[model samples]
Target chain A: MSDSVPAASQSNRGDDFDRRDAAWYVDRLVHLLVFLGGVSAILFILGIFVFITREGLGYLTASFSPSEFFGSIEWRPTSDTKPTYGILALLTGTAAVSGLAMVVAIPFSLGAAIFIGELSEGKTREILKVLVEMLAAIPSVVWGFIGLSIMNPFIIDAFDVPVGLNVLNAGLILGLMAAPIMTTIAEDALKAVPDHYREAAEAMGATRWQVIFRVVLPTAKNGLVAAVLLGVGRAFGETMAVLMASGHSVNMPTSPFDSVRALTATIAAELGETAHGSEHYRVLFTIGIFLFLITFCINLIADLIVRGIRKK
Target chain B: MTMKIAIETHDLSFWYGDFQALFDVNLSIKHGRITSLIGPSGCGKSTLLRSINRINERIGNARSTGQILIHGHDILAPEVELLQVRKEVGMVFQRPNPLPLSIRDNVLFGYRLHHGKRGLKSSERDRIVEKALSKVLLWDSVKDRLDHTATQLSLEEQQKLCIARLLPVQPEVLLMDEPCSALDPSATEAVEELVWDLRDQFTIVLVTHNMAQARRASDECIFMLLGKVIEHSETGEMFVNPSCQETADYIEGRYG
Candidate 1:
């Protein structure tokens, strides 16, 4: 309570002065700038999502029900009269092609990843890794071109179909395009697992395959799921490859050999020809919303499954 | 009543890409006894333990020469399958590395690997789990949460679970490479108690830097310096009466 109190308060005042120095202000200013920089991309993405939703919401009026958008298969947005906007055909086409692509890709990519991560060594492993990365670097348009020029004819000859551009053809091409990415990601996941797990499993007398499937794969389950989700995402949103490979016939895909049209191709082909802010243009935005929602749901479901595995 | 030799390595030498790690390690480990390999850091105690089960060979460039005989079978023979060798000798690592799986699954991991999954009934597998967990004294704490992930357990419990997982396979020998090095003092003592309890059933070769643990836990002790065995004697004799100057220096804590 005596003179010591004033001395302590004087030191506190000096500390406050130090806290408000030029260096401190500059540090805070830099931090703010970095924080703003980090958030700008997220802000732009949110802006796009909100803008698309605002434009798309007009189509959900009395003239167009949500069921018409989701339930019907017809997609004739340009018909002067009786224009039907059913997206079921396109949706089925996307689903079928993407599903088939995953089925074709998962086994081969996972096996290749395991082989590279667990089996290969020295120059062989190095060469395989470089080749996989190079495969990933190939342009999507080139993959589309390859599918159209080479695979279409092969499929047309093999199945004796009049049209080579079908769900199977598109799916096989998508699978090939997605393989390098899936293998690279899965291999990274496998290699990231601590060596201790491998040693423990091998010590328990597990064969290499057993160790890979039982220990390594399960340990890296989250990353593996991420790899598959990213692969499926790439296939689902692909426009050029699916458009070039899949015959643009808006029909319900009854079989793998049936020609189909994906939602992305429809938008790409029609958006340029439609009048701005017209009903057809707004419907395209609605389709964009659908694409966004479906991809969002797939990611959410995959995340939940990965979380469940982690919890176990 | 001389015990049978459970494991024997004759002139065993190991190399990692031209850098020799183990040089002419010759020793016979007796059945149903605890033998501790004691040494300073990088003294090849852990290397010798791994070589017994061919775990050292997992490294990309690691190569070994000479014979390792287990139960009268030469494991280092060209015809001998590494799978068979590994199956016969189980190992535990320094860190508790339980698979990201349920506790029950971890216990049955080795069992299901050796025996096909369909061959064993639920009740049989349950019995094996209970037996193994009880052996390591981990049943009471984790008995309620068998479905919980093994990683959720404490370091002590996880280490115990790691030991329990090795039991279902009925391995002839168990190699522990500084298993308690990652544990606290209390957990180290607890694991040492479990290791002592496991004696006389499975042949145990433990690599440890702790002189106290070697003396208190192992029946026989092998002291190494720079990849060469300095002395192999009874624990009490090694501690009370060390023959080699290096062994005496290590025991006296003159320098590691």
Candidate 2:
């Protein structure tokens, strides 16, 4: 009986069990494919940083002046006598528009997040979440179109401004563009706070508003700060909408009604017109590097704050 | 002599989105005593505890049809204030859930909710914090670091803090739902001792899965099976001679 069993087991151990079959090779192939998919994100970011730095290196080595680039507002790059590439006006415009966008977006997004994450139940929450995601998916170009056609006319009619395409128009458009993503992230932060905390607070006779303001919001404060920072990053890097709405002028904007030009808008509008190896092209690449560094730092800070909370 | 009933329930039935959890549960828990509800998993003990303060209504589809009276007041009535019901009846969860605040603030959280911050002096707040923390036997350890976050404490201390936070409200009934299930053996013993100490001042309804815990810690024992009370007697009598066959089967090693 032992001999017969051994013979049967040997026969059963055919090529499928003894050797690597098709499944083994397919598994190895999938492993390699997934590894590449994970590593490609880091690779793309590094490649873009290197390429922009190389393109801007010529201007940085030869004619770049920190004071001239950051202090002066003159940006006449096509002058016959002398060309100046100072970006003070562009910096102020970007800062103003982003600052104003944050002011407009913070309350709306936080209120929406509180409603969706804390107040609403089943169907209302699901529907509002889907609508916010759809709003985030709307293209920046379409937002630009709205800013140019609808908001421009409304501002002109309402405030009696001579030119509607100014800081107020662009800031309002960018604020709307940033609100959906901010709302989604803030909702996620509020959701991350455990339900038991709410239960404990409610069991202690706290009203709904008291529970939210005292316990839930305090627990999710770090995540909320990260969400606001991410929204600021989004507002700072926006180009198409700001270009279409900001009137694209190189003026130091002293008021919301003054026309201005952002750094991103300047790069987008003038990159195609400048010669490939010219100083103007290199300066635009330098602006790209500045933007890359700012957004990268903001995201890094947000990530660190999130990781801090996780560690706690 | 008659025992005063702190919490009385009549014809209590509960459902969680069409799944019936409790059917016709009528119980009168006496004041200033530790009554334990012992059963297997999904026996509706926790549900019943949550229903005392009307906190079960927080679940979206949870519904109950019954009269739950706390000190002769119908808490389930429409005109009854929910905040008032909760203030009079405090609950402790199986898992320790201290608020994300300092130790002082956590102890003062319920007090601050009931009393606004406008007229509350800092010295008065400190005294309240000390009194609540001292009641749970946590003042000696955590008094030095009152400003530290409450979540940083050990699980045993966190559970103690959870109890302490409920004391400032001065609730008559303290409903504990497996308060020591998350603790280690030693922590469980400490929490059980604390619960026993507090029995003289507050009526405690403890839900426990451990039969040993029910046998040792409770004054009155309640045996439940399949959402119905099998027996309710003195802890010694219930353990010595359980009247119902189902109660005997559960108490013994036969089946849960």
Per-residue lDDT of B164-207 in model 1, one digit per residue for the tens?
Answer: 99898888899998889999999999999999889879999999
Report the lDDT tens digits of candidate 2 across residue range B87-194: 899999999999989999999899888987578898988899999888889999988999999989999999999999999889999999999999999999999999
In model 1, what is the error at residue B131, expressed in angstroms?
Answer: 2.4
Tens digit per residue, CA lDDT, model 2, A64-133: 9999989989998898899998999999999999989999999989999999999999899999999999
Interface RMSD of 2: 0.6
Model 1, A128-150: lDDT tens per residue?
A: 99999999888888988988999
> Largest DockQ belongs to which candidate?
2
Model 2 off-target regions past 4 Å?
A1-19
Best by TM-score: 2
Q: What is the lDDT of residue B176 in candidate 2?
A: 93
The alpha-carbon RMSD over the true interface for every model, in angstroms, is: 1.2, 0.6
